[model samples]
Target: MTSFSYGEFAYVYDELMKDVPYDRWVEYAARKLQENGLSAPSILDIGCGTGEVSVRLAKAGYDVTGVDLSDDMLTVAQDKAQGEGVQLSLFQQDMSQLELPSSFDCAVIFCDSLNYLETEDQVKGTFKSVYDHLEPGGLLLFDVHSLYKVNHVFGENTFTYNEEELSYIWSCFQGEHPNSVEHDLTFFVYDERKDAYDRFDELHKQRTYSVDTYKQWLTEAGFSKVETTADFTSDSPTDKAERILFCVQK
Candidate 1:
């Protein structure tokens, strides 16, 4: 299997995700804060890959600090923030052992980044870290892939994307654990000068636990309240929902 690297992939991350509903994600955070009767002037964004949502939130007039494990990805995020004339504080840190100099009114782990933690302990550690960094009665928001999506939707599936400048073939295989999957991705990028395609590959793995497990971990991490919604909607999840969003308070 090819090794995992985002150095090359980070350059095209925004182009590939141009269709993602980032504005909705920002609005969701705002609505959740309003629902809890909390005012949010500062936020901590954990696992903030490429800073798409982080930049959006900053533009919405919030003080945003972003953290991610990938320096390559953080480089892209910094460039985007500069181009938009928005200031963002970014750090390269592992979410599982997060550390920051300050606390905030809200913290978020959106875009299913939690799935990258392969073990329960890692996830719980991340929750505890977030709890430690939050002000009293602060809020935490996150989303993860539902068990149905991992076990069925991505089970041994092969998908392809083709475009004028780039193309890719992605294959997914079951991992060693339940609700886990490994992704093997091959990319071909057009070289305009040479009139040829340059190829690169990346491998990634993700795991998700049951909703009950997540709730238990949040409680153990000292979150006072935890509620869940499905697929960006303010409703309880059904068995077939692909993603689950969590709203918790410290």
Candidate 2:
């Protein structure tokens, strides 16, 4: 029941996720574009948490529009874009139901945001909404946590890490059903400058569906040529893969 409120940790999200190799993912997408002869003047980044990837794409000379449901997260993104002088258009919106001025040339939903949708209707609705907001022949790339990884690695994982100033307790519990994992995350942050301490607890739930189910949903949502791969490379998904990235065309 601990939805992403982002009260105190909103300012620290980018700092924590900076280690994520988002540039690598962008490179993968760019290579896919080059190989497939896909060129888009503009792109819509759905579920763009803090707009890190969108900002990178902007550095590569693309008009990027980042959208997310959290206003706190969007504020951080706006600040970063202003500070870095990146011309990004960020909006507070939901992926399952979006209202935009016009369709985009391409849309990206990265960082496993698709897993945040807890229900089947939400996933199908999001895909259908994306299809409606894309131009013909446009591309859509997204990633999801793999069921295999959820069942094996994250099912019963628990660990603790303590840095010079801050400490954290991270645990994962198997969720109800065929494809779900619950993250029991607790952060004990220390402000060295003020010798103060604060704590934050978050319970995150993520799920993955079969590739066939996703393809069916994409096809029903008007997407054609739905394909999935392991990691960012063009490889088949396996039991040990962390995430399954889906590449679909409008």
Local accuracy by lDDT, each model: 0.91, 0.83
Q: What is the TM-score of each predicted model, taking all chains together?
A: 0.96, 0.93
- Which residue segments of model 2 deviate by more than 4 Å? 1-4, 192-194
| RMSD each, Å | 1.4, 2.2
Best by lDDT: 1
lDDT of 1 by residue, 1-250 (tens): 3343698889977777888888877889999988887764689999899999999999988899999999999999999999999999999999989878999899999988999988888999999999999999899999999999999999999999899998889999999888899988898888899998888888888999899999999999999899999998988999999999999999
Q: For model 1, where is the 10-residue window of minimal lDDT?
A: 1-10
